[model samples]
Target: MLCYEELREAVDNGYIIGDTLNVVRKNGKVFDYALPGEPVRPWEIVTVESLIDIMTELSNYQ
Candidate 1:
C-alpha cells in the first residue's frame, strides 16, 4: 500500500488507471486524490470502500 500523496502523483502521471485496480469500481473509473474542482486537478470519485481494502491490507503487514 502507498500513501495518498504518492498515489495521487502516480495517478497524475497516468500510472494508475482502470487496469491498476482490483478493488470494486465506482462509476467505472479509478482515482488517486484531488481537491474538488481545482481547475488543474479536480477531485474524482475516489471510493471509501476501495480505500478500506487498501488500508486493511496495509494493517495486516509486518
Candidate 2:
C-alpha cells in the first residue's frame, strides 16, 4: 500500500500525472474519487479502498 508520504512523493516526482484523480470532499473529508476521464460533478459515491493497485501500476513506470 502507498502511504501518504509515498503518494505525495510520487506526485511531486511527476510519476502520477495531473488530473489522474478527481476527489470530492464533504465536511472536510474525502467522499469519493473519480479515475481519469471520469466526471467532475454529480459525484460518484465510491471508495478508494486501497492504493496497492495504483502503486503497483506506477512501479512499472519507475
Candidate 3:
C-alpha cells in the first residue's frame, strides 16, 4: 500500500493514471480506497488511520 507522501507524489507526478477512483468511507471518514477497475466492497472492513493523518498533512499544506 502506498503511504500518504508517496500517494501525493504519485498524484502530483501524474503516475496514478486511471479513469475511475473509488474512495470508500465509513462513519463519514475515509476507510479505504480502490484504483480504477479495482473491485471493492461498499462496506468498511478496517479503520484507516491514514485518513486523519492525511487530513492533518493537508491542513499543514494550507
Candidate maximizing TM-score: 3
Per-residue lDDT tens digits for candidate 1, residues 1-62, read 34445554655787555423333233553333333333332333343345445544434442
lDDT score for residue 6 of model 1: 59
The reply for model 1, stretches above 4 Å from the true place, is: 19-62
2 or 3, greater by TM-score: 3
Error of 2 at 19 (Å): 12
Cα deviation of 50, candidate 2, in Å: 12
lDDT of 2: 0.51
Model 1 TM-score on a 0 to 1 scale: 0.31
lDDT of 2 by residue, 1-62 (tens): 22445665766887556534444445544444455566566544544434554445446545
Comparison by TM-score, 1 against 2, better one = 2
What RMSD does model 3 have?
Answer: 7.0
lDDT for each of the candidates? Answer: 0.43, 0.51, 0.51
